[model samples]
Target: MRADAKKNYSHILAVAREVVTEHGADASMRDIARRADVGLATLLRHFPTREALFEALLCTNLDALTQTADELETSNSPDEALVSWFQEWLVFAQSYRGVVAMMAAAHTNPDSALYAACAEVHSASARLLLRAQALGSARADMNGDDLFALMTALGWAVDQPSFAPRADRLFQIVASAILTNPSSKDIKNATR
Candidate 1:
């Protein structure tokens, strides 16, 4: 990319983050362009769609989550690692205003711009999940996709301001549901 074009792309992404943080993933592209002091065509040329733009923002965090899962696997017990990773994933899911729906859509649709990112998230968590299951920690019947579903539901629950405080309670319930032998110590460690 040319220097000026690269600058415009960076400016647009930065402004889009600000706008989406305040409004939502559904925030208007035109508004983002205006905020970046770029024309709508320029914004569209870089982003093409709102999903693509959000995917770009999410890709960084998703990659971090993958590394987090990897690091946790080596640093903690299987159950603790899985629980801790899921807890962190929940927090990331709430980072953007409207990312939950985008993630959910991506899960079922291979064509979505966010699909690859969603799949990478699943793959990362799956390693931890398989480890837990192999060690008789997590329920054998479930897989990474099931955990993703639970995370999606939890994200949806926390998406509402009225239910936000209940996220921890929901997390507890989910842990109980998924763990074969839930321990207070493991759960406590995960919360940290």
Candidate 2:
């Protein structure tokens, strides 16, 4: 793609992501185009339909989470890295409340991009889980699918308006459940 075309595509995706996250999957592509300062033709050239755009947006977020997980692997302890990655993932999930729904739809659609995006998330999360388990910080039996399910449950909680206030607490509770010995309290007191 040309420089300007690439710039336009990036801008459209960014704006579309922001709009969809705030307004939901039903958010208008025309509005996104206007926000991106791109024409309808340009937007369509990049994303032919609403579902296509939504999938691209979902992929972008998943890609970012994967990159962050990769970076966290080197910078933090295995347990801390897992916790940090979950925190970031939950935040992204909460921001895009419709993601769970989209993923479910993707599962049945066969042609949906969300399926591939979800697989990417799964692969990245599995790496983190395995690393934590290898370091004896995470439960030995916990697998990638289990972690993914836990995340989905937490995301559902985060999506609820009533549960939103307790989202952070919920994350801590889930983290505490997965960690091996030396509970969060013990680890915190030890550090102090």
Taken over the whole model, the C-alpha lDDT of each candidate is 0.86, 0.79
For candidate 2, the per-residue lDDT at 37 reads 86
| Per-prediction tally of clashes | 0, 0
Q: What is the lDDT of residue 178 in candidate 1?
A: 87
TM-score of 1: 0.95
Model 1 RMSD vs true structure = 1.2
Best by lDDT: 1
- What overall lDDT, based on C-alpha atoms, would model 1 receive against the true structure? 0.86
* Worst 10-residue lDDT window, candidate 1: 183-192
Error of 1 at 19 (Å): 0.9
- For candidate 2, which ten residues in a row score worst on lDDT? 183-192
> What residue pairs clash in candidate 1, if any at all?
none
Clashes of 1: 0
Model 2 TM-score on a 0 to 1 scale: 0.77
